[model samples]
Target: MADKLKFALALALVAAGVVGFYLLGEQPLVLRVLAVFAGVGAGVGVAALSAPGRRFIDFAREAVVETKKVVWPSRKETVQTTGIVFAFVVVLAIFLWLTDKSLEWVLYDLILGWK
Candidate 1:
């Protein structure tokens, strides 16, 4: 219950900051930006104290660990894969273009007799 209230308050602070940005349009740009940043920072700080926020932080840390464990492809492998993809795309495009031209010729020259 307390966590929920903290989350709600954080959300309200962020919302107020966004609204304040518009309301402070006549003010200096730097001040308006600062106000918005302050609001967002405060909201995030408050929300960070909640259970869900802690869970999210844990999840993010786990994700980073998992990401670090990933075996990324080498630069050479990446280049070879990209080259193969480009070759396949070029071949498919040529095939489709030929198919389209053949159909156009058959329809106009043979069947329609308009040519």
Candidate 2:
């Protein structure tokens, strides 16, 4: 299929860029950036040519549209949730640190008999 060929060509381009990055050691920064871009373009082009890629693109577009229709949380709700998360994180961190210290003390002092 034509799609297969395009995919193969894109893969080839990406492979060439990877190889070039290692081989073309003294190339200018601009050239290197261009090579990387070319590789990415080739991959996207190949994916575009494939049926699955088209399906994925369509699904992604629909998801974005749906996301736009969402009613996001208000500022107050966002702040409260963020504060709660921060407090939980701080508490969890202290708990973990205490646990780690207790384990270390037990292992080094009691089990191994090391001061």
Candidate 3:
């Protein structure tokens, strides 16, 4: 119940910030932008107090940690893999083109005598 209230308050805060931005049409751009940022920042702070919010933050942190631990391919390995992929793609394209031409020849020249 408390968590739901917190979430709702957060959403309201964000909406208010957006509304304020539009409402302050005659105001300076800096002020309008500041209003939006303040609202969103406050909303996020409120939301972060909720159970689900905490879980999401934890998940995000863990994701960053895991991403950092990843063994990314070196430049050489990346280039080699890319070259292999391009070669395979070229070969496949040629094979497909030959197959299509053979089918077309069989249908038009041999069977229908249209060519």
Candidate 4:
């Protein structure tokens, strides 16, 4: 129940920031942007006090750690893989075009006796 209220308050804070941005139309652009950021920061702070927020924080930490363990493909390997994909696509396109032309020849010239 308390967590839900906290979430609701956070949402209200963010909404207030957006409203302030529009209302401060005559104000400086930086101040208007800051208002939204301040609202979002405050809202996040409030929400982080809740159970779900803590879990989300934990999950984000875990995701960052897991990402560090990833082995990214080297530039050379990436280029080679891209080249292979392009070659395959080109070959497939030629094959399909030949098949279409062959089918048209059979249907129009042989079957219908029309040049």
TM-score of each: 0.87, 0.66, 0.82, 0.81
On TM-score, the leading prediction is 1
Model 4 stretches with alpha carbons more than 4 Å out: 99-115
Tell me which of candidates 2 and 3 scores higher on TM-score: 3
Judge candidate 1 against the unseen true structure and give its global Cα lDDT, from 0 to 1: 0.94
- Per-residue lDDT of model 1, residues 1-115, tens digit only: 9999999999999998888899999999998998899889999999989999899889999999999999999999999999999999999999999999999999999999978
Using TM-score as the yardstick, the better of models 3 and 4 is 3
What C-alpha lDDT do the candidate models reach, one value each? 0.94, 0.85, 0.98, 0.97
> Which candidate has the top score in lDDT?
3
* Order of quality (TM-score): 1, 3, 4, 2
- The RMSD of every model to the true structure, in order and in angstroms, is 1.6, 4.2, 2.0, 2.2
Q: Which 10 consecutive positions of candidate 1 have the poorest summed lDDT?
A: 30-39
Model 3 C-alpha lDDT per residue in residues 66-114, reported as the tens digit of each score: 9999999999999999999999999999999999999999999999999
Model 1, C-alpha of 42: deviation from truth (Å)? 1.7
Candidate 4 per-residue C-alpha lDDT over 1-115 given as tens digits, one digit per residue, 9 for 90 to 100: 9999999999999999999999999999999999999999999999999999999999999999999999999999999999999999999999999999999999999999999
- 1 against 4, candidate with superior lDDT: 4
Candidates in descending lDDT order: 3, 4, 1, 2
Clashing pairs in 2: none
Q: Which regions in candidate 3 have their CA more than 4 angstroms from the true location?
A: 27-31
Cα lDDT for residue 38, candidate 3: 91
